[model samples]
Target chain A: MSEKGLLIVLSGPSGVGKGTVRQKMVESKLFEFQYSVSMTTRKPRPGEVDGEDYYFTTKDKFKEAIANGKMLEHAQYVDNFYGTPLTPVKKMLAEGHDVLLEIEVNGAMKVREKMPDGVFIFLTPPDLMELKDRITKRGTDAAAVIEKRMAQAKVEIMMMENYDYAVVNDKVENAVNRIKDIVSSEHVRVPRVIDNYRKMIKEN
Target chain B: MSEKGLLIVLSGPSGVGKGTVRQKMVESKLFEFQYSVSMTTRKPRPGEVDGEDYYFTTKDKFKEAIANGKMLEHAQYVDNFYGTPLTPVKKMLAEGHDVLLEIEVNGAMKVREKMPDGVFIFLTPPDLMELKDRITKRGTDAAAVIEKRMAQAKVEIMMMENYDYAVVNDKVENAVNRIKDIVSSEHVRVPRVIDNYRKMIKEN
Candidate 1:
């Protein structure tokens, strides 16, 4: 019996290397997952196309989608609304494709509440000192901004309790392999197999 | 921070390829686990060394171990006592090694009750007809004996509800790989990480 595809939510503290790890995992082709296109009210960044990097929408449109229950989960951050659209994810799962939602802590919690069957994974830094160093080495933000982000990291780390699994991004390869292993293993759960067994028994 | 190892118990109907699957899983070496040596009052078969195949014990010694609370779980089958020892498993976990226990359904249930930490895995054949075919092809038993075993198979398959994960043994290699993936994924449990974080917080 073919089981339904999984809904995997990947959440991490900022600069924990989840983006890179996810890229590597997707490259493996071991899983059939759609990388969700988030709907955002913010203008697209340079080289990022609307509906590709994100489904860029006007503030009014974003609000309408939320009101119409078109968004699975949404959160307002930095004065912009960002959310996961329900339609594409639902369509993908129905086609037996797993859906990967690369999101933050707040959005992950919201999705978990809506879909208890979803797999929630938290990507973590190896240690706080390493996390601080990594953020500083990025050189994108000023020292003050880096410090602020590190402080926020502590709060985010605390929220990891809400996740089903935690993988430390010590190395990109290891983290990606770990996530892939989780996806492969979760498919073997009892409910899925038992449902298949029941169906087989009925037919035979 | 290091994570704690899992206690995994695997059981299935006889001739469902449980042993072959488990053997292949151990050969993968992706997981660090000690195969639990059960204490048994039955005489060892040819080429079976004490403590290697099974821990040969006198009925009196088995009773004494039970009285001393040394047995994780025990049962009387065909006038012989068979049980899992508690001490070595605890020692293995304390040393950061996962433990794999292969036991009957009742033994698995009792271990779950006593430890409440072990992971129960139920392995099933692809279909009842295939299960019967495998039993007959093995040719170790007479036709009447094979029929009786097939009857017992149904009873065991019904016990799949007791397991945390149910894997279909359609192919030995696939089942083994799935088991390895499950063990690796379970290593990322929240409690294990939170424990590490708590200790680190205390140290700092």
Candidate 2:
């Protein structure tokens, strides 16, 4: 009964494995979902495209877009700005394509304010201790940065209230499977499909 | 994240394959769910037990239960009264056992009125033409009865708005799998599991 595509937002605290889980979901190709192009002030981490992967832009330009309300949801992580472009995501959804947005928790909350109908999923680490281990194991952040991230993770984990689903990032494979099920299940959710059936009955 | 049992109500128009689909779901042994014992005024058709399969009762006693608001939902079908006893279902849910109830459309709606939290599923045939064929092929109803059932089917299908999910009974296996996904997906629904996470995070 669902013809229009769904807006699925995946977000979580830093070091919760949201990035790895989202990467696997896209690579699995089990679902027909399009990726949203986001604007970022951070330099590309090798092989990332300018428009396809992210819109690599200056901090001023990113701020301009934010001020103009051109960004759907934006946040600063590790002193670099990242935000999703508003128009493209809407255009994709309007064209009957499901859009998947992998964003930070604050940005996801902003997206929820603008698109309350979107499916918000929170990816959490198995435990706070495990979360701290993952962050420290990354080896790129300094000890102070790691400590800051641990504090932020606790606050964001508490923000699970803003999500529609809480998937534990215990294993990448398991988390993606649960995500796929949620997407498939949402397609058959009564509110999403009942109108088509209502119309079909009248015509039949 | 889900702890309390989910109340799953499966209903559809006559000949829409709700019973067959529900049977497969239960037999699949994929989900941990219990079945509710229904009260039926119809005589047992061999091998059916009074308390196990259905609570065999007279029309007067069934009416008395209905008048007492003991039945969660009840309806008269083909001169037989069929209903679900409320207290038992509630007790099962309280004990953290998911309960699946398969009933006719009218009874399903009545259940919705009382327990809006229940997951309501509407089983549908591939099409109205197919629905008519299924009813006719049963070969038990008279011509007038078939006609009445077909008319009732349209009304029931129109009542699809009252459900949370609609699965097409084109193939029993496919429908059951979709049902399994929905059940798994419901376990992660934010409202159902958010409080649990909130408590976990607070303790951690």
Candidate 3:
């Protein structure tokens, strides 16, 4: 059987170390993982590459893509349209390269609707206090914003049941290894391997 | 949430190197895994421990256990009764130790009927030719018996579709590592971890 690449959605609440885990996974080179670059109307920050970080686009272009069904899943956050572009992800999967989409819970849920077979992984902090500490230490957001994010985090944690796997990001290295294991094991899933076996049996 | 250990069933046709892989897994000391010892009416061979190899039992006792619904699955092979004792498996699982059962396809299917939640894995040879070579090299069975076994292997390979995972035993080390990964990843399954996340969310 011709193996198809997996569409893996890595999502978690804010400050759950999803980014750190994903960064380590990429650095490890354990698997041929291609990030599904998201299209966003938000302007790029300093040191952010246009295509590498995100496909920064005009609001009108993003809306046009949405209207044409080019966006797999899109959401508006702080008046900015951010969504996964369908074309690249589809191309990557068709070429047998596993695609990783690191998005928010809402976007992940939306992706689930379009691609139900995708592996949805939710990365969680060891504890809520740990999550709070991580966010607080970042110092990027105001106290009120962090509080709002924490509230949102609780709601997102409740959505963990919707994922295929829930990995606790207790340590970045361990979390990355777990994700690697998950991906490796998923390749041998019965449905995916049955056709190959059938062909082999026929040949034999 | 309190974690319950997994019931993992490993099965394969003859000459698939299941024993070697299991040995490697045990030697790694990665997780607490206990074997679900089977009871057999056949006398133990040289250097075989009664409990460790198989729980040697009288034919009468084996029949009594089968009648009492104690055998999870049983079969008559070479005029001897071989079966898995259900009580010990349950006890190990209750004690939070992952249980491994290495049995034939029929026994694995029977176990599936009894414990539908168990993770069933089918180990396979790289190809039928490799399987034939391995079986031939063993120098135990006659040519006629080997032919019969090859036919049985075909049937068993077809049954691989019913398993949760199909791992090719091309290399013992790789197969062991893949099974290790599967066990590690299965723990983080969404349904298994959702309760823990719910409790944490509520507590916070």
- Model 1: residues >4 Å from true position, as ranges? B140-144, B201-204
- Native-to-model Cα distance after best TM-score fit, residue A193 in candidate 1, in Å: 3.1
The number of clashing residue pairs in model 2 is 0
Against the unseen true structure, what C-alpha lDDT does each candidate score? 0.85, 0.88, 0.91
TM-score of 3: 0.95
Q: What is the DockQ of candidate 3?
A: 0.83
The lDDT ranking, best first, is 3, 2, 1
Report the C-alpha lDDT of model 2 over A1-204, residue by residue, as the tens digit.
Answer: 448889999999988887788899989988899999888999998889899888999999999998999999888889999889999998999888999999888889999999998999999888888988887788899999988988888889778877899888899999999999898888888788777877777777
Off by over 4 Å in 3: A140-144
Q: Order of candidates by TM-score, top first?
A: 3, 1, 2
TM-score of 1: 0.94
lDDT of 2 by residue, B71-185 (tens): 9988787899988999999999988899999988888888899998898989888788898888788899899998898888888888888788988888999889888888888
**Per-residue C-alpha lDDT of model 1 across residues B92-202, encoded as one tens digit per residue:** 887888999987788888988887877889888889899989988888899889889877877777778778788888888878888888888888877667777655534
Q: Positional deviation of A7 in candidate 2, in angstroms?
A: 1.3
Assess every candidate by TM-score.
0.94, 0.91, 0.95
- Clash list (residue pairs), candidate 3: none
Docking class of 1: medium
Worst 10 residues of 1 chain B by lDDT: B195-204
